[model samples]
Target: MGAHQITIVDMDIVETSNLHRQALYTEDDALNMVPKVHAIKEHIARINHHVDVQTYYQEITSNNIEDILDEVKPDIVIDGMDHFKIRYLINEVCHKHQIPWVYGAAVGNKGTVYGIDFKGPCLKCLLKQMPSSGESCAINGVLPTIITQVASYEVAEVLRYLSGEGFSKKLITIDTWHIDFKAMNVDILKNHACEICANQHYSLLETKHQQHIESLCGRTYLFRYQSSIFEHAHHLPGEIVKSTSFAKLIKDDDYEITLFKDGRMNVYGIEDDEEAFKLYHSYLKALK
Candidate 1:
């Protein structure tokens, strides 16, 4: 609703490992940065002086979500995150409050961007299930050009919508490998049974799903242990592998731990959820 001031709520950070696909970052860019929100805010300020920006270096968990939304009170929200969990939360928040937000994703040479208006179908309408467990840019590999292209398209749509220009409620897909682009018009395919929008259910904002830390999409996770556990983490016997400056990947025989500064973990090569929990506890004990 406002002119140019937009608040960006992101919990991740700039990392050396992400430089390839993170076109906006350099090793020194995140040398001492603790959160992604801060890094992105600074980057935007440096490049686009016409935009008003604020950064929240905290996760959009159930507990602090309402408070952050209220604090930022953004006229428009943007999806700078790779994870879908928080996007779900944003959808619910925007729809309930009548705010609009944009969604974007890039992997390898491909990506997609879409805008969610308050009056139509939301993210849930595009898919029939939850995100499957798998690899990410950290697990797989992404090029800088693709990520930049995706974010550029996302911002383009944001600018258009914010400036009284409306975008198609359809899905926009692009494949940079072949330079192919297509916009699928689906404005009439909105679902009346969407659990988040149509149901008026704000379950994600209720505080139950919020974990101490969370792994976003892209085979990345954060291991946020209690402050008391910091010193103990040194006792663990293996090198903690990390993405440039974005995420830490710690692995051993039975498992791999992808941890972020936000205190979340993405456990891979393990089938059992209980085992994931056990691994989490094992790492927690070491950190303690």
Candidate 2:
């Protein structure tokens, strides 16, 4: 298969914290303001320039979803997003479109990888019995080894499916801390009368989840908005404040926001690169 035929949809950025477990990143890689998808694409290109990679620097919310999936037209989608909202979005979009996708999650020293081929149970099918999302790395703090291990398994599954190696329709969980791995059959449960699966309902993807914000002393980068336009405002350089505790508001030539200790802030300046760049640095000072 040609490299250009595969496109990974990841909208996150490389953070200083992710270096501890992410194997393919360097200090300079994290320093660059590139989105995680682009960063991974660039890294892959170094190994094989023939691979066609793409990215969307915006969060997967109710808005801008069609544009993302439409632009990618990927043969299969991979899970690189941390946001549960986005994960569910991918699940529903894939199920609705009948485009199979893989599910994976890692945190601390454990993770899981599974595939959702058309004949197998989907993420929503599993969620009918389990919780909405698996344990997130943000809350548990992922180990570099754990992410690498889980990601490698995920990639292996991808290769298997694409190379006609054929993947098992089972859920695979790995616990690196204990060095345990297990896979169980789940194909039959897909049609076992589940709300999200049997009934073909996808409440998680259909709903809109809000993000919270917090203010810190000596800095300001929080903004409040009740408009849908603000959803796509990601490309415009702005912090999304989900909390209402921040009472103080500030603005400058091209940025406006408030800051809190919880590390949440908003930016509203000139909706362009120059202003976004300046505000990002200014916010970084507060982040420090």
Candidate 3:
């Protein structure tokens, strides 16, 4: 498949642990501590100079999803998103825009893939109740086989949908460790009247549910839904690397860390929120 342009967006930087499953990243990238979007963009550019590559060094949240999608205006959006909240945001925005997107997720050698054609069986059907803290590839661990398998299948579906060939509406689940593949039908779309699929309602776009602290213009991207655990800047348990009225930056061997007094953190130098949260919790424990 030949595409004129591709836009890659992510809020985190490359990490050592991600190399096993995140196929596009390399050891050098992790060591260099480059942002994931930047590293991927450079890699793609080097591989194919003809294809235009664009990257957004920011997380895809409900607030920014619509704007990003509108700006990119891609033929189809691929679901490289890590968790359900953002994925659900993607589903809602894509369907609302009448755009098609593939939904994919993998953890513990198991991978799931399905196409949302803006037609039937959107993600909301499968996930009636979103977990407060969902299972992620980071927490449960993942094998490269499953990640690539699901990604490749998602690409195939994208191509099929773009080529007028269409894609299977059935939910495709793969157990790569066991070498088992199942394409089973999910009846949630048939049974439940999904507000997303039935009515053209995407409330996530307007909702400001995620706890965000924006003091600086563009220095960091921080999104933590939890309430504050620390009250004041002086109460910061971690040895303060630098302190300011607006925020406090900390030192971490792995992460370029920034923590607010209210317990909000903006962790740079690592890819994905899981690792950032891990560091954040460890610091909290150390303080205790």
Candidate 4:
């Protein structure tokens, strides 16, 4: 908690649905549609003005993750994402950079926390392959209590790693609804043949594995292309709903677009990939 500097990265804005589980955001934030990174920077300033806060209103993709980590040179990295694709990327990059990291996840009153010191087993070592899609908070619902508990556990591990106390080398599993908590040694899970950690092969870093377009929850789509929206600001065809230093929200009859300065666009109210790609290409034409 007393860390002198903190870096936060997120491309999403505050949504009314997030209020139940995410404590840092307020109803006003959702109403104003504040980017999560900006909201966090503001809140953290109120909590501790002495702490230097660096915010990046961008998503972590394979194309930019290594550069982001290289620029920050963080002593440790913490995982707060919902999907495993990004986690795998983080795991591989952090492993390559020799930075320790803590992996955490919470859904439906159950959560898991594990730490990797790079000297021992890593996430790939424990999870040999990408897991099958499972129930998410969007579908199954999560308790606010579980989010807080899991986050507390993650911060504690960060502190432990930063203080040179070392890791417990145990995977913590918690089910708060049943008041069950278990920690089992995970050092035995290390595989000598693991590609990322043991053999130093980072597959997730490859661009071919990274999709530029993705279907998000709630009929939303994200199109990630690295271009400066400011260069095409004059040609946007929608009413500017909201404009910020790092991104702009534009809305038309058919779609709502939040285009970042780095060209990551999130389109809301789209249900089909064909329509989504059509709209994306039309915008690209406009930009040209």
lDDT of 2 by residue, 201-237 (tens): 7675566654432121112223323333222333333
Candidate 3, run of 10 with poorest lDDT: 212-221
Instruction: Report how far residue 139 has shifted in candidate 1, in Å.
Output: 7.0
Q: What is the lDDT of candidate 4?
A: 0.83
lDDT of 3 by residue, 148-206 (tens): 99998998888889899877777899999899999876544542478788776778877
Candidate order by TM-score, decreasing, is 4, 1, 3, 2
What's the TM-score of each model vs. the native? 0.79, 0.68, 0.76, 0.85
lDDT of model number 1: 0.68
2 or 3, greater by TM-score: 3
What is the per-residue lDDT of model 4 for residues 1-288, given as tens digits with 9 covering 90 to 100? 469999998878887989988988999888777889889889988988998999887778888898898899999999898778788889999999999999998888899999887898999988888753333645767788888888888888898888889877889999999999999899788899999888999988875555667776556778876577655755868888777666677888888887877788888888678988887788777887
User: Per-residue lDDT for 27 in model 4?
Assistant: 98
List where candidate 2 sits over 4 angstroms from the true fold.
129-139, 208-288
Off by over 4 Å in 4: 132-137, 208-210, 229-239, 251-255, 272-275, 282-288
Off by over 4 Å in 1: 1-4, 30-34, 48-52, 135-140, 211-221, 235-275
Ranking by lDDT: 4, 3, 1, 2
Candidate 1: minimum summed lDDT over ten consecutive residues — where? Answer: 212-221
lDDT of each: 0.68, 0.60, 0.71, 0.83
lDDT of 4 at 216: 69
RMSD of each: 4.2, 9.7, 7.4, 2.9
Over 1-288, each residue of candidate 1 has an lDDT whose tens digit, in order, gives 334676767656565666666655667765643466667667877988788777676666767777887887776777876667767877878888888888897777788899888887788887646575333555566666777788878878887886887766668888888889998886766888888778887777665644643444443344456544333334654666544344555677766655554555555565554555666677776665
